[model samples]
Target: MSKELRINSNKFIDQTTRLSFKFNGEKLYGYKGDTLASALLANNIHLVGRSFKYHRPRGIMTCGSEEPNAIVQIGNDPSLTDPNVRATEIELYEGLEAFSQNCWPNVKFDIGGINNLLSPLLPAGFYYKTFMWPASFWEKYEFFIRHSAGLGKSPTKPDPDIYDHKYYHCDVLVVGGGISGIMAAKLSAENNNETLLLDDKNILGGATIYQNNDCFQIDSTHTNYWLEKEIKNIKNIKNLTIKTRTSLAAYHGYNYLLAKENLTDHLSPDERKGKIRQRLWKIRAKKVIIATGSIERPLIFNNNDRPGIMLSSAIKKFIDFYGVKAGKEITLFTNNDSAYETAISLKKSGVNIVSIIDIRDKSSSKIVKEVEKHNIKIYWKHTIVNTEGYRRISFIEIMQLSDDGSGVIGKKIKLKTDCLGISGGWTPMVHLFTQSGGKLKFRSDDNVFFTRQE
Candidate 1:
């Protein structure tokens, strides 16, 4: 972890407080400002979870709502163990317990990992085809399959925490806390728009909090200085409500969104003083500008399900945002420029870089130039043919791809690497827009889904 600490706010918290928590039945400690993800990382616990399919090892991906891993079972009771809850979004509270899912014995050395070797016979939709003929046999197979499938166990007892809902009217509801979202909320609140910024992260500032690239020149003062300034300025604006650690679960008619606020999750599990544990806010907004930004998509290839291999978005949060070393050495593979930024950031951590493989033959991207300046080996028009790793990554075979990056044309180049950060480009988070029944138009250049003007 980086020793250069940067404190961004004193509004919500002012002291370096400590909290106790449990993981996989073991007790641990975390700070007040730490998210469940950061707290887990701080405990030097990697492999916070297991993969959905294949039962592979998994860790925290994105720092905010885009987190694809570190989903765990919490609390002693199955009902209180929040399934699919993002560790990156949960605040650290005393007695908070978490466990990795999808394993019979444990997350590591999962007996289900034997399924990886048997994966050749179990292709995608294998159960759909194979389990049909012996429908009666499927009943028995599904019984074992369901037991082998999914992570975390539900609490058998009823939830002890009280959860409730309330109605809140606001002139502006910012769905994301990214750069654009923060700026938009600032303008709206300044104009007396009764603004409310909603973020799924324990802290705000979405991607800007993680990304270290100079694409937009985000002020590197840490903890989103601009976000703090805007929120500070809006303190007296009577109508502005900044809800952090809140997710807009559902959208109803009249531009109303059902938002869940985790109020006492970061304190003590028993600290609810008649206050709702989780409050559902029914927010009615005058206008909803979805600056929700985008999520990093992983490039599909053979053996991409390996333990250490992860999305480029995850590398940024692990290194830049949370000060956690993602791995000893990293190999970043991408079809775009952002992966280069991940490589550079990791290089600064004194970790060795095996190589940066790009799918493009040539490009004018500034990231390309930066990589060249660092003298890092760049294999253009190359893609991973296969990855080899057990329990963790050990090697990846890179093959030079054709100009369109669809086929291999040159000899294969195999290199030893621990991690492979894959970036297939950004997917626009248009869930809120789609929830509003908005139309969508495809962007050929970006090749991503986006909301269309209705």
Candidate 2:
């Protein structure tokens, strides 16, 4: 059920090898390098699941670890079926079966949707407030409450996968495998340090690897090309060890860390037999370098959680990295310059860019100037007031911001766009840094809290 969203050819995805998988019992096809989320978007399957409380529709929100929706159950076996797995993280494999969660009788026509109408009577913690008053009927209410709660089912039998643990000590440990992490690993290793780099991905190089823009250059060469050359240089460093598909789980005192390294999650069932499925790494490093990058903040508006609404960064990766078009007609909304990057990428791919709605006054940056050259429509000081569409976004209503930027002042203008990409700038990932006895200072300008040093 491919929607023909794929571009002609992509070096990253192996289109020659087509693998079929099941989603809600219907077979779908994806390439060797496609994630379950990317494949669904390619098949034009939005509105994958339903919200837990109100049963409002939910779709694949993000492309990576920060995904808030698109959770599904994998497999049908009593012993091997895995639940609560993020669709964005699961790599496409042969014979894989995934079903949407949090709904009964399927996601499209869930009976639990009645709760949305009853939402006024079922606010947060309403079950505790409404049910506990009559203590005599507690047992009667328990049966119905338990049946209505929780997502996915637990395995009925013992897990049949192998799990192992190991220990190591390194002079320096660098987290994240983006361009910054790659350079950090290489520099640490070059100084005769036993450096270890960890990234929770099957492939190395983060979002920067897919950045093929002409303006993003290094020494007269595109940044992607330059970073690829650096990746090759780090592989030969004897003191450096790079571990992909591994995640750091905990940070303990005395420079001790706990990491989970997946061994065969991406491989097919037959290929995974008798192999270590996952390995827990207990490492002690003299020093730790946390280069865990930032996450793009999303804009908030009425009905912003619609299926076709996604982060601008995610749309960029879907096209440039996965070689899939998010939508045939797309519009972007932003308060920063990042969404312009998405607009440029979409324009280069021969996709129709309806327009760009920026909440701030116009400024002429080099990238913004380049977008102006394309003669794309720009609505300055405008904000999305509401979105329209039942399952996927079909139209967006925008209004010019007031002089004080607190309210709307002009008449609402409606635009037809299948996909809406919104960017609210980036928030630095400082959880690991703050967890290790570090404090943070709130930066209100960009709406981010950054680590503050002593």
Candidate 3:
């Protein structure tokens, strides 16, 4: 449980304020602006919960709303207990109580984990097929099925948290608060258009907000610093309304949308008194800008769902934004140049980067060249065939990619690492657009889908 307390850290987090919280009955301390996932990683507790079918150990794999694992029950009060909450998205606060979900006995040692051994007999949909043989017997099997299902426990008492709804109408609406979203909002407001910018995160600037790299700069200033000034300037704009911790849920006809705004979710329970916990925002805009940004697509390999196997983008965020190191020795695997940026950040933080396994033949990008200058070992045209570890990743098996790019052609090379950062590029977040009847065209070159603009 070592913390990388680099003096350069704390751009987003407040190291001055330490917060104490509990997970699975174990108390831990984190900074004021930390998330449960980040704090847990900082404390070296990767195994958080168990998987659905096999009951395999699941960890904090991502750092945002897209996190599929690390779900848990929040609080123990009958009226206030929230279930199946994403730890990555939840803010860390004093007296915050959370417990792992879907595990009997405990997350560390679960009886359900035996499902992995009996997996052959179970197969996919084994429970459904085996129990459906006799519909008459379903009545007898209903009790057992009901008991084993559900990820978390529902509250028995009525909810006491305050929630409200509101409506807004703006000339232009931006769905993201990233760099592009900030620029779009600034321009729209300066042009006398009433602009509304919404982002799911409690803070603006998206992933680029923490992106600290020499290769990424604007107007001779670092991208993050430059964006800070733009964000500050937008605050005085009369026509602009910036809503952080607000997520656009739906996009309907005539540019009408539904967004959920978290008013007091990040606040302490005592501070939340007389305050609305959440607000449902009904927004209408004459024009909409879909700057929802992209999410890092994770690469699939054997046992990729292990506790410490995370996306490179996530690993970067854990280090840069939260001021915490994901691992002492991390191995990065990628097919693009994105991983190089993560490598630089890790190296700058004094974390040992075991090696970089790249599937691409090579890259001449500035970021890649910078990584080369650091004398970091990069295996070009190489891919990780499999990763080894149960509760967490211990090492990965790598080999040279064949000429046809379909198979491995060399002897297996094993690399020892505590954490694996994988980058499969990114997928454009066009869900709202597609939900509103937008069509997509697949780009065969980089293998991503984009809207077919008019």
Give the lDDT of residue 448 in candidate 2.
89
**Model 2 misses residue 449 by how many Å?**
1.6
Residue 252 miss distance in model 2 (angstroms) = 0.8
In terms of TM-score, the best-performing candidate is 2
Q: Write the per-residue lDDT of candidate 2 for residues 1-454, one digit (tens) a residue.
A: 4646888677788989998999999999999999999999989887889898999888887899999988989988999999989898999998889999999898888999899889998889898898996799999999999998898988999998889999999999999999899999999999999999999988888988999887799989888899999998899999999999999988888889999998888888889999999999999999999989999999999999998899999999999888888888999999999999998888888889999999989968989998999999999999999999977899999999999999998798999999999999999999888877789999987778998879
Off by over 4 Å in 1: 1-21, 26-32, 39-45, 122-151, 210-215, 218-228, 270-275
TM-score of each: 0.85, 0.98, 0.97
Ten contiguous residues minimizing lDDT sum, candidate 2? 1-10
Q: Give the backbone clash total of model 3.
A: 0
Model 1: per-residue Cα lDDT over 1-454, one tens digit each: 2222222333333236657788888777766666777666656555777776667777665566667777877666656667777787777777787777777688877887777778788899987787787667877787877876655666677777788889888888888877788778888887878889888766666766554455445355444454566556655666567788787888777898888887877667557567678888988988887888888898889978666677877776666665555566678898898888787777665667788888887779786787788888888878889988766678999887776655788787789986678899999988878888888999898898787876
Q: How close is candidate 3 to the true structure, as a TM-score?
A: 0.97
Assess each prediction's global lDDT (C-alpha) against the native. Answer: 0.74, 0.91, 0.90
Judged by lDDT relative to the true structure, which candidate is superior, 1 or 2?
A: 2
Stretches > 4 Å off in candidate 3: 4-8, 134-136
